[model samples]
Structures are given as structure tokens and as C-alpha cells.
Target: MQRKSWKKPALIVAVLVAVAMVTSFCRSRETAPAHGNGAPAAVPIRVAAAHRGDLDLTLKVIGRAEAYSTVNVQARVSGQLQELLFKPGGHVKQGDTIIRIDPSLLQAQLDQALGNLAKDEAQLVNAQAVLKRYSLLIGKGYVSQSDYDTYKANEGLYLASVKADKAAVELARTELSYAQIQAPFDGIAGAPLVYPGAQVTANDTSIVVLNQIHPIHITFSIPETGLAGTQASMARGTVPVTATLPGTKLPPMQAELDFINNAVDITTSTIQLKARYDNHDDHLTPGQFVEVVLPTTRLTNVVTVPVVALQNSPLGSFVFVVNADDTVQQRMVSAGPSSNGQIVIEKGLSGDERVVTDGQLLLVDGARVRIVTGNG
Candidate 1:
């Protein structure tokens, strides 16, 4: 009985102490600040002023450089290759001789055709003179009508032979001219397939490959969604394009939009486009991969800001606009297309406001901000 009584008294004391502790905690909670310190510390951030400027709608795509023109030089006439006029990888101009076949045989054939032509011409002249005299005698009874007709027929035969011989001469001359293979255009020539002393067949032998590189073409594709915009830009006049080499620090190559395929590629859902670059500096090479930036639209005189300034929440896309008092006001924005590190703001925030580009995570409406960059 004594032990049980002592237990009850100790238990009562413990209950009272617990109630006092609970009361003290409630009081401390009531007295404490609701959010952080009573004096809110200023949030550090970087900002950029919204300004009226121009921004281009562009997309970067991988493009492949190609020769403006490529041709496989072939022999038109059969002969033993006498000389390779150009070294492997040599540059040749239009009509420059790149290969030479043994011309002695062709020369002899031309001479033979010339001789046949001369013989036919002489015979035609003699027959024509005899036919003229016979015609005069036929009228005066010095020659019979049948005899005159025979002379006239002989003259026609010689004339026909001369015409045939002339055609033969032209053909022979054409064949002889083919002995020296000429470059079709200004280009770089590949290694000759047929060396000197090698027999080459007409139209069956490839002498070299020529690739025109001065004005290079870059072929690439863009998403079909951009096709309409690209077409619109093209309709406004020449659309500008820029090509950059992947691993070089050189400035980008400026080019013009040259061709857009009539139809979209069903397999890839992309529209093929080609850009022409005057690669006069030899900066671009055929078969090289490059990054091509094509501007689809040009938005001018619009309020724009850095893309990072735009933020999103459950509500919508918004930005923290800093006031002259260095306080932030959350404003919902209708964000348009973004490009070149900037985005166009179609609504909210005029061109005179400053926006927080960084440290936006700690920002809220009516929150104090410290402008660490841009206008203080």
C-alpha cells in the first residue's frame, strides 16, 4: 500500500511537468517569426533590361558539304594513253587538257579523210565543167541529149561523193579532237585511272574525276514544322544562312538559301533544303560535316530578354520584374519563340522593365531583390 501511494504522487508530478513543457513550447511558437528572420535578407540575382530589338527564328541542323559539280572524265575516242597531263589532285581550268592519247594514229586517219575529200572535190569540179560544155552542145546539136544527160549524172555522182567525203572529214576531225581529254570546268582532278602507255577504250574508260569546289553546296534538312516559315522568309527575298565548321575557330561561312525540295520527306518528316556557299577561301570541303543555322523568320522591334529570365510554375510562364525600388513583382508572360540566347515576349512586362535572369529560384511576388548585375 505504501509503495502504490508513492507511485501515484510521482506520476501526478510527472504529468504536471509534461503539461508545463507543452505550454512553454506553444508560447515559443506563437512568439517566433512566421518566415525566416524578422528582417528578410536581400536575395542576390543577375538581371537584364527588357529592350526593343530584333530576334531571328533559327534552328541549327547538321549539313554536308558537296561539290557544286562532279564529273567523271572519260575518253571519247579509243587509243593508247600517251601522257597524263596533270598530277593526281591537280587543279584544272575549263577546257584545260588533262589527258593525252597517242595522236599519231588519229592524225593519220584525219590525213586520209582529207585526201579522200580533196580527190572527191577535184573529180566533182572536172565533171561539172564537162556537164556545162555538154549542155551547150546538146542545144547546138554538137552533143546528143543522152550524152549530155550522162555527163550531168556523172557530175551529180561526184557531188554526192564530195558531200559524203566532207561528212567523213567532220567525223574524223571530231574523233581526232577527242584524243586530248579536256576538263569540263574549273575543278580538282582525281588520280588518272589510265597512265601513259595504257590502252583506253572509247566511252568505256574513266580518266579522272573532277569536282568543282569553289562554289560549294551544303545539303541539309529541317523539321517539316519549319517549312512554312522558311517558305515565307524565302518569299521575302534571299534568305540568309550560316555554316560553321565543327572544330575550327574560324568565322562562320555566310551563304544563301538556294533550293528547297518540293515535297517533304515522308520517312523523316523533314524538308530538304540546300545552301550555296561561295567557298572562295577554300574553307569548306566536299563531304565535310558542318553546322548550318537557318533563320526562318525575323521578328523586329519586339520586347526581348534573355531566355533564362523566363520561368515557369504551375500557374504559367512568368518572370520576376524588378522595380525601381529593387523589389520583384511576378508577372505572367506569353513567351514566344526563342533564339540566339534571347526570347521574344509577346505579352507582359514593357520594354523599360528589368528582369531577373539568375537567382530566380528564391524569388516571389513582393520579395526584395538585390540587382548584382545590369542596372543597380
Candidate 2:
């Protein structure tokens, strides 16, 4: 009985050991990192190739559309604002009669001046005839010399009066013409400050503002850093510019660089530029905000990459370039001006390498990669 008991205990111990070993083996298998063919796991990522192409660098800035010219249409003569021949915000042509003042008062003054001139001319003619008679009588001794001299002096006085009267008539005519106000150019007339029957003073009252919308001038500013490039492009020819309104389907309006400020603004560190566009359809209005795109410079046959591929770190800007062996290596690049969606790689790229654009979080330097989409 003792031998049988000892053998039974030994068997139990053996079975327990076997069971513990199996449990430990299973736990080890569960805890180990799984891999196929004992290879490291690959990171899933998308990539775009660093391409070689001519990059036309451009700069986009906010601009304001302004009238080519603006003028304040004021009353030239002081009188009652009798008629406003233009509608508020209406278009007017050059020399179009825009305002008609009450001409009755002006006309009366003109008539009075004209009557005075006629009377003076008639008196002048009579004085000349009397002077001629006096001359003939003096020669014949029928009139005293003093009487002749007096008549001659009177004739000169009448002649001076006639000359003065003629000048008055011209002045009256000019004053009469001022009763009608004309437009100086083809433009949009703003609100009339003075209504009809309201007395307005010449050159003092704010009557209406006229703005020439066609051939609109667009004013924009750029950082002083871009001044050299802009001037270089201008030296070759007029630098081209285009304006567009956001949230609209209209095509970009073409313009040319027409003016550049002589000095940079000290406070803002920017330079102002003006572009002109022939807005024949009158689409662009003064004071309307717009987006202006201007070509700043051009890079020839340079290595470029999507902006997304370029990454920033504490050190500087860099990108992940995929090697021939399907591995990625972080490449330090000298980045230049960015245009559209691409940035010029001024250094560290040979213009044909594939750069990792996505799945960057799953990547490290010298990590193996599978080109999922044949990034090129």
C-alpha cells in the first residue's frame, strides 16, 4: 500500500508539471509580437515623387478695386439746384449736362448786360460822328478850339464806356453758361448731395461724386522682400497680374503693373503697387475687394515636391525620400518660394526621388516601405 501511494503521488506531480509547462508555452506564444516570415512590420503610407520641372513661382495678395479716376461734380455757379438730369448712381458720358440750375436769374442778368452793351455801342457811334463834325468845323473856324477839344474828350470817354460794356457782356455770357453743369468724363454719378430747389454754392457744396469705373485701377501691396523680383520682371516688360473675386464664377480679370511706389512703407515694411485693367464691361467697381495673383519669379528645371511632403522639426524643414530598396530616408532640403501646391527644393534633392507624402506617422528614418500607389 505505501509503494502504490508513492507512485500515485509521483504521477500526480508529473501531470502537474506537464500542465504548467503547456500553460506557460501558450502564454509565451500569445505575448510574442506576430510577424510573417520573421520580417519587421511595414508601415502603410502614400507618397509623391519629387519632380523636376520649371516652377513658375507666384504670389497672391489682397487687392482693392478702385476707379481709374474720381471727380467731385460740383456746381460751378451759385444758384438754386433746379434739375438733376442724372439719376442717383447713374452713368453719364463726357460733357453730358448733369445739372441744370434755375437760369431765370442768370438770364435776366445776361439780358441786362446785353442791353447795356447795345446802348453803349450806339452812344459810341454817335460820339465818333460828333468828333468828326468837330474836326471839320475846327478846320473851317466855325467852332472854338476849346469846344472841339471838349467834344473830342467826350468821344474818348464814350469809346472807353463801349469797351467796358463789351467786356461786361462776355462776363455775363460766361456766368450764364455756368447755369448748366456738365460731366467731365464717362463715369458713375454718386448720390446727389443737394436736391433740386436747394441753393448750392459754387465749388463749396458737395454735389455728387463721379467715378470712372472702366479701366479700373487695382491697388495692392507686397512685402518688401519681393520688390527685387517684381522690379526684375517689370524690367523685362509689364508684369502681368490677374484679379479674381472669391465665391464667384467669373474669370480672372487680366491686368498690367502700371505703378510702383518709390519707397517702401517704413511702418509696414511693404511696397504699394497699382495695376490697371480695361474693365470695359464695368464689372469691377471701386472699393470692391479682390484677390490678386502676380508672378514673382521663375525657377528652371528645379526639384520640386508637394508641400505636404515637406515636414518641419526643431532642426529645420526636411522630407522623407524613398530609396531604391523600398526604404525611406529623411532628407534635409533647402526650401525656396512655394507656388500653388509645390515648393522648390533648392537643395538635397536630385529631382527624381520619391518623397513620402502620407503615412508619415508610421515611418522612421531608413524604414522599409511598400509603395502602395507607385508614388512618382
Give the residue spans of candidate 2 off by over 4 A. Answer: 1-56, 140-148, 297-333, 348-376
Q: RMSD, each candidate, Å?
A: 6.1, 6.9
TM-score of each: 0.82, 0.70
Candidate 1 residue lDDT tens string, 11-31:
999999999999999998778
What would the per-residue lDDT of candidate 2 be over residues 123-216, giving only the tens digit for each residue? 8889889999889889988999999988888889888988988888898789889989899888899998889989988888878899988788
Question: Local distance difference test, per candidate?
Answer: 0.89, 0.88
Give residue 76's lDDT in candidate 1 (0 to 100): 90
**Which segments of candidate 1 are over 4 A away from where they belong?**
1-46, 52-54, 298-302, 313-316, 358-376
Best by TM-score: 1
Report clash pairs, candidate 2.
none
